[model samples]
Target: MGAHGAPRGRAARPAGEDSRGAAPAGRDGYFDLLRAVALVRVVAYHTFGWAWAGLVFPSMGVMFGLAGTLMARSLRRPALTVIRGRLRRLLPPFWLWGFFVVTAMLLHGWMPDWRIVYWIVPLGDPPGSAWAGQAWEIVWYLRTYLWFVLLSPALLRLFRRAPLPVLALSLVPVAVLTSVPPPEGRFGGALTDLATFLFCWLLGFAHHDGVLGRLRPLAVVLPSLAALALGGWYALTHQARYGGTYDLDDNPLGQAFWSAGFVTLLMYAKEYAGAVGPVRSRLVTVFNARAVTVYLWHELALILAVPLTDRFWEVPAFERYLPLESQWFLFGVGWVLIAGFVLACGWVEDVAARRKPALLPGGRAARMGT
Candidate 1:
């Protein structure tokens, strides 16, 4: 039996130990579940309205926290090795998806509409005054991810020597500079969004430093839950006053608090819930194994699903019309298309990984399957 009394295959450790040769047994299943949940939350939050908005931002923070923890362990490598590893893992898949989207536009005869989306979709500027179109909204995450990887070395070094309070306080300037007042549109300002990235990454660093294990779940959960409840209420109450926009500062604070609570809850889930059933575990494992592929292909999946389904069923004209029922339907349709792309386009990334494993953290290839 695995740690949870389930089979041992659920959370597969990396093919080998980390670069520093540490044992991989310390892996956390809850973190895997959390990543899976966070990816879903992102899709759902944007797709299903704000029903779970309280969870999504914090979940991302949890992911960043986890990433930071891992980074903390790897900062000692030579600069070339670090840069190479990160680029190999992050870029190949990104480039493949970019090509796919660009091709789709050409085939659909929508090349002219590409001008605005071209920017935001490729981690460049958002369209003129308006936000980029739906086909490419997910790029925001990718754009931020690129920035994080670029700064990982410096961030890792700074946190390695600094006191916890010093590192934590170091983020204040970033938070303040980013937290300008809310904009007119529901769109979040770019400056404030940085706070979310820093907050999550720092949390990850702390997690690596054994911070969560120091606090009981209850201690972490209570205040976080309260923040989400009250903070959300406050945002909604004043959201309209800000011209339908949600404040990024308000959003990140709520998300950070909530993320801490969820991370604690996940730790408990592993200790208590045990195996999540074999079939479910296997399914989640497959999805998680190809996580980067899934994330990279999801946007393309959405774009492709629209046209094929459009022949028979029409997508809702407005974003609001997409409810749970509609989302589930879309989810079903999306899986079929994305699965095929994973087999084909995803292979492109695997090839690059094999050729230059050292480009990823600790010189590891992203595993495609068990």
Candidate 2:
């Protein structure tokens, strides 16, 4: 459920989506398209259990790369300032979401743990409770992002001084995490997940530094393909190792290499820029404008739709066909509910960002954030 393809740690979209604005003359439409597609893919995959989609696009990789690139750009401003601004933008809507979730769970008879205070303002993966586990799981992305953003000043400096070595060092975590089982503990596992994607995050730094764009396309492309191939081979053989599942998420080492390659290719920076039509433009605007709200609330909609759809299944005509259980039908329900949630809560993102509010922030209004 994490919107994986952008600067999503503090904000939902990449730095491209950092501002509420129009094309601004030089912005690429495809990044917006990439973020939009990644957001949809994360929600759809979570809803439909689409493992192939993760392999196909690797939304988290795309997101880390996007975030890393943007963080690099933001480094021009003071690091402390950048972190503060990001937190200010991120926390308000998140606090609102947390309040609703916690209140609901409390109403359902959850005894509050004093530890529950962490979830109220989570900096690491918020500990999930028995009552609303699925919703709490999404916090992993934000929590990991929090640490990465906090470390960026140093990480970026290390990367700048010794680009190749720093990147190679990043992959070391991938190897350690992948080859061995993480000791059973919250801190250990969180670090492992952070390591799983660390290389790609650094690769994002390389992209921002022009390391990727300067290379021959074949230099990046060929190695990335080879790494992906190796990842596939490793996963193919390890089917016996995991619970007979082919999910790459379970294979931390393989995913790190694969995502590093993927991010490298995506951030090659020299890739040609493109544009889309008015309708597509509006869609991108809406997606970026409400990205954080949508990412947070879409899964809630999916969870609620599960019980709601159960009622629909009781209809005699639809019972036979199981239309209510159809993947497409569930996706449609989630999408519509998400739209309504966006209409209701998206203004929080705007108000938090100090951007003007609109039911659909598009066209000239989208550009107003400059």
Candidate 3:
């Protein structure tokens, strides 16, 4: 039995842990479930622009932290080997989606730029069809994740020797970015984002290495609360800077502190959070397997929702029963499209990961069987 007597079925596991190294015992609870929630929250934030998503969960930081923790585990192998495995799992789905989006751009009358070959693997922000611009924005996560993974070996070594000092020093880059936001066109802005989020990424290393996780609850909680308070004060004081919202994205210093606080709290609380039943386990499996696919295609569904809703509202039967103005109608329209894409394209993740392809993680029948 897993934590809390859960089955710890295969469904509870995330991909990328296959055969490489067995996860430490008792590691199943929060990682997969939190990652799955973070993925959904990110998708929701993009689709709906919900302010509460960041305040409630800070999904992007959670994702980076999760990636960091997993990367820390992978680093047990040679650095080059770890990088190769991450890129191997990450790039295939990216390439598949990139090709489709690029082709769609061409059909939409976008001019062919030979430079778009960069979109094939997207080392940096590779240009694609203007129509697909929002779709490509999410690639920044992949780009930054790639950089963090590549740098982990060196970063991890520093952390192991002087963890507190190294973590404190990581905040300096975010300080610079917060004081002066980076310029728009060059790599400065991407570098700034990476710097701002780097603290949370490092916190993940602390979690994995027993630096933070072994501490007494109050020890972790007090520092986390202090960081949160500091960030909250900054957000409140600088409301005018972000157009009167507390969004961490527009406020770099705020993000640095807020994400660090959030990361520590979640990792520290791993002792209790989990999903234990067959039903929940299967959901986690599907979510974990389809996570990359869902992230890649959600923006496309969002873009298509506008036109699809406009067309659907024209039908009197649909319009009368489900008013176009209703939130339910909007969510329904968006999710139905997302689900369609998931069924159609979710297998791309499996293919990219070199697993046997299935429409969803385990297919409908397998889910039912579980």
Candidate 4:
């Protein structure tokens, strides 16, 4: 069933229902609102742009935490079983969306045929790399998610045992790796350094075991706040220092702080912020119901919107628009059209879910890290 307690259709229910007769692990309106907020941030940050790109980490941390909550819940079953079920639900929409992105790019002459392979393998240049322009930029998250899913079993087991120590240790790599400058001629400069996501995901797993509640509120709250404040400051300063552009991997301090804030927020959401109602409740019901579809098609909408904005609206090339200073009206209008296109393709995800290939009893991908 979905968050509203309705059974989802093929286009809808890939996330599966919680045993509590609602969305898996049941619904948390705060999280739904958070997801909505995060999606909006992504839209704004990408469309209109923001100087403090560090702010994006908070949303990412929350999203990763959400993924962990879902992952922890699935741990009741054998790791392989959980893996198979998740892949069955996840991969089809990804494959569909990828095909759609490639088709749109080709139709629009965005690139040549050989370029489509990068999207398929999900191994293109990072956002700043030469080949980065050739790949579907927004879809990079999917590549990371696929890696996370592939590694879920080991990650889940580690969290299940020695949860706190595990979470603590995971952060060491994030600090070390994220702080280092990206190597030349590489696209995945930040992938290794951002270990906080793994830590946050594991923290969610432990929360399922009541680990967070055992700690005092101040213990969690103060550190998270400090992280956010300090990180935000660093981000702003760094932008000013670098003439206003932040390399994705440049803000380890901010990412660390944001991840901490995410954990604090999740704790609050689980305890005091239960069951928000009416408008949020309904919006969650709709979005969670169709999340897979929406995610799959969102990039296609972006790609299609690019041409229309250029051809009809006479907007400048996407990269030329200054994010921090762009007029909200022009950006908002383009986003509205893009959002509509995404909504229209929502049904296609349902079709893909129903037609996914079957997995063997235990065989899933052999640890293909994103």
TM-score for all predictions? 0.68, 0.86, 0.86, 0.70
The segments of candidate 2 whose C-alpha lies over 4 angstroms from its true place after superposition are: 1-26, 269-280, 314-322, 365-370
The per-residue C-alpha lDDT of model 1 at residue 123 equals 41
Please state the error at residue 1 of candidate 1 in Å. Answer: 26
2 versus 4: better TM-score goes to: 2
Clashes of each: 5, 4, 0, 5
Candidate 3 local lDDT, residue 24: 57
Error of 3 at 322 (Å): 1.2
lDDT of each: 0.53, 0.72, 0.73, 0.54
Error of model 2, residue 299, in angstroms: 1.4
Model 3 residue runs over 4 Å out of place are 1-22, 25-27, 112-115, 271-280, 362-370
Alpha-carbon runs more than 4 Å astray in model 4: 1-25, 53-57, 104-118, 121-135, 179-190, 193-196, 240-243, 246-253, 272-280, 292-326, 352-370
Q: What TM-score, to 2 decimals, does candidate 4 have?
A: 0.70
Q: What is the Cα root-mean-square deviation between model 2 and the actual structure?
A: 7.2
- Ranking of models by lDDT: 3, 2, 4, 1
Model 2's alpha-carbon lDDT is: 0.72
Model 1: residues with Cα > 4 Å off, grouped in runs: 1-27, 50-59, 106-132, 166-190, 216-230, 241-253, 260-280, 313-327, 355-370
lDDT of 4 by residue, 234-343 (tens): 65667754556553334655565566665665654453323343333554444554565555455444445566545544546554654423356445655666456445
